[model samples]
Target: MVNNKQKDAPHAQWPEAAQTLIALMHAQGEVARLSEREQLISSLLVSVNAVLWAFNWETRQVLYVSPAYERIFGRSAGLLLADYNQWRDSIYPDDLEYAEQSLAEVLRKGAVEDREYRIIAADGQVRWLSDKCFINRQDEPGQPVIIVGIAEDITDKKHMETELQRLATTDVLTQSSNRRHFFECAHREFAEARRHGSPLAFLLLDIDDFKLINDSYGHPEGDNVLQRIAECGRGSLRRGDLFGRIGGEEFAAVFPGCAPDMAVQVAERLQQEIQRLRFNHDGQAFSITVSQGLTNLTEADESLDSLFARADAAMYEAKRQGKNRIIAA
Candidate 1:
């Protein structure tokens, strides 16, 4: 019903306006999608097993903590949020200094921070946590920097690693330190004694006539004897003493503050205890004796090897002389 000029004029403007409306609709949809995605991510972080946290440098405060805080720390999130010290105080005393150093380094140098430390939970369980954080600087010249991080519970992994290390360093048969671990420990102790001029003693002990026992009573009985001797030695030694099984039917002990005279008494006591140990197999009962060689840290000693050599010679002398006596080198 309209003229051609009127219809053409309206149609010409309509395409531009329609295009604008379509573009606006698309922009709105995109914003909504982003918002929904952000919400989903936030929800996931709160429900995740790991704890999410944010700290403000200016306020020296914890600005945010995800819900997993309660699960990991065995305390209410409200307590932590209300008092920042609540979390700081929960850190194990031994690890507090290291944690502080890590945080200082991150803040001062904008470094990527990663640390592992232990924390005592409210339930009295010790838990290990692995923390990783990154710094976010504000655009303004004097604004507070923010730190964002995640903390993961790593107690099981730490325990497994500790058990593996123990197995590696311990003798499986005697349940004492192996030869390598013993030497490693002795090296450190020797250095310490030399540095501080402290008295230290080393003892080399061997079972007398062990081969005869194995031949007479079978290898199993010999093994039981070794285990029993190790148990007795462990019980008789001072708390600070280091004992290890270095070879078949041979063991070593390091005494960190004991003089040569005192070490002789210790060896004599251990010998008596070994004699007192009674073993019953089937219907027979028997006892065993040990030969010991004792040596004290000397000014001439340069290395653990030198000390061990002297002790070994003395032990062989004990075996040669009556087979069940203490000899000093």
Candidate 2:
């Protein structure tokens, strides 16, 4: 028989060695899983179109910034993490106060959901951001006060909103104020004039023999004439004057803070300008004229409607007496 002590010693240590090997394998598996999870999170953050950030409010330090920061802000994320002032400097100067105030409001309110502002990127492009922030430790007094936020690029949305507003308020043909917008602005001006006892004038003008022109030359030529007249009105009016195309071949103007004599002079100048415009259609040349009715604010006037009525009446009188002149009511 062999030596029994030596055989028993080898047998005794095998179990311990096996246990150690098993433990090491389990630890390696756990580490691999954790690495995969971390990689997944990094990929997700890189693909997102918004910036996710975390900051230490007490220390005023940027703790973390997502990959999208570089794309949206055109700046380095490393610089931002090194100094929080990078964020402050990137904000549009006009919006800095509001941005900081709104961010600070998150501490008291626990969240700020609708903070929209502009930021100047590294390349000098102004971009709009819809940033929402929250206080992570609002209830824990002893913990570090951390602020976490997400900012989305909203420049395209802001541009779309501006375009829609322009389309709503503007005339397509003449690019002047439409009838509804004109009245809305006019009502506000009328109220302010009434409150201050300021001088204001209303003028209604219509193209003379417009039907004849349309019938003789066609609607295209008629549209051309209308566009030219609108241009003349825009060029002749004062800075504060409001002009609009209220109807076909009809335009209206409101002159705020204009005296009666000055209003007359302006109308006369517009008349001469229109009289000088010459157009050719089908190799035949023709000229156009306009009839205008003007009225000034009076102590006895009750409302803007009264002024409109007086101007309308005077405009018809001008049409009846002669075709191409202005009459004051």
Candidate 3:
């Protein structure tokens, strides 16, 4: 059985699918056709994709739930006996307060608004969601008042957002963080260091003579070298460390709590790790070495551009000094 919260189920006690038809027929009568309008309103409530939470402002009893309520909520609205506060048990704990506040506001002015919240499925799965409500208020005796709302499933949109974030930050080839994301994340680390008066370090690494390997062995062999380097980088860094594929044969590492000297130690370790990488192509075994540049975060100005400039300059110095060496800036 599908739950009310599952986005596909029955929610209406009275089926009113013909009200839209009534609204279209403009009748020239002396008196108002109140029943026709009411029917149209009820059918609309049943057809909407969102949950229609309707209540009598005076009685405080829920008068209606759109047909999709069970589909989106999992629980039966009729079981609550028109007491909408029964939603307290059905709603996700984190969203209950917001829901209650919105309900209060709606009751106060019958204001129309949309809200997003996490709700529990009938089967106990948590899902992200949003709902739009259009409320109608009345303050007379022997007359019906209603609050109409539509609900839509936004879980797919939320998942898409998360996946996009991953793509933006992660390198497609090596599944490591990408260069842009590396810099973006490193800035946050730098800010924290500046706030706490801590040290931050960076290492800019490049494979030694990678073009020579590509020329002699072919691009495939060079790719193997890069992949091997990525694995080594992952193995060398600790948790909370950020390492990225900064370029074709270049990489970067951000160490949040390390001094310039310690950064040099890390750069040297990475260089040694790269030297230990062994690969075989067409039954031929070979090794590769890496040159690295190190830099420390300073209180003078903790900016991404400044740090990158220092690291890049130090990296060029390492490259100039016969490659395979570490230079600090």
1-329: candidate 3 lDDT, tens digit per residue: 75766543343522443454454454433124677787888788777767655566567677766677787777786865566566667778989999768766765665645777778888787777776665664567666656666667788898999899999889887778898898889889988988898888888888888899999889988887888888888988767889999898999999988877767776777778888778887888888877887888876764767888898898899889888888888
What range of 10 consecutive residues in model 2 has the weakest lDDT sum?
Answer: 135-144
TM-score of every candidate relative to the true structure: 0.89, 0.88, 0.67
Q: What C-alpha lDDT does candidate 1 achieve relative to the native structure?
A: 0.90
CA lDDT scores, all candidates in order: 0.90, 0.94, 0.78
lDDT of 1 by residue, 77-171 (tens): 88777788888899999999998788777877776546999999999999999988878877889877888888999999999999999999999
Off by over 4 Å in 3: 1-47, 55-63, 78-114, 124-126, 133-148, 231-239, 261-276
Best by lDDT: 2
* Candidate 2 lDDT, 106-222, residue by residue in tens: 989999999999999999999999999998875656899999999999999999999999999989999999999998888888888989999999999999999999999999999
Candidate 2 wrongly placed segments (more than 4 Å): 1-23
Clashing pairs in 1: none
Error of 3 at 167 (Å): 3.2
Higher-ranked by lDDT: 1 or 2 = 2
lDDT, residue 63, model 3: 75
User: Which 10-residue window in model 1 sums to the lowest lDDT?
Assistant: 105-114
Per-residue lDDT value at 241 in model 3: 84
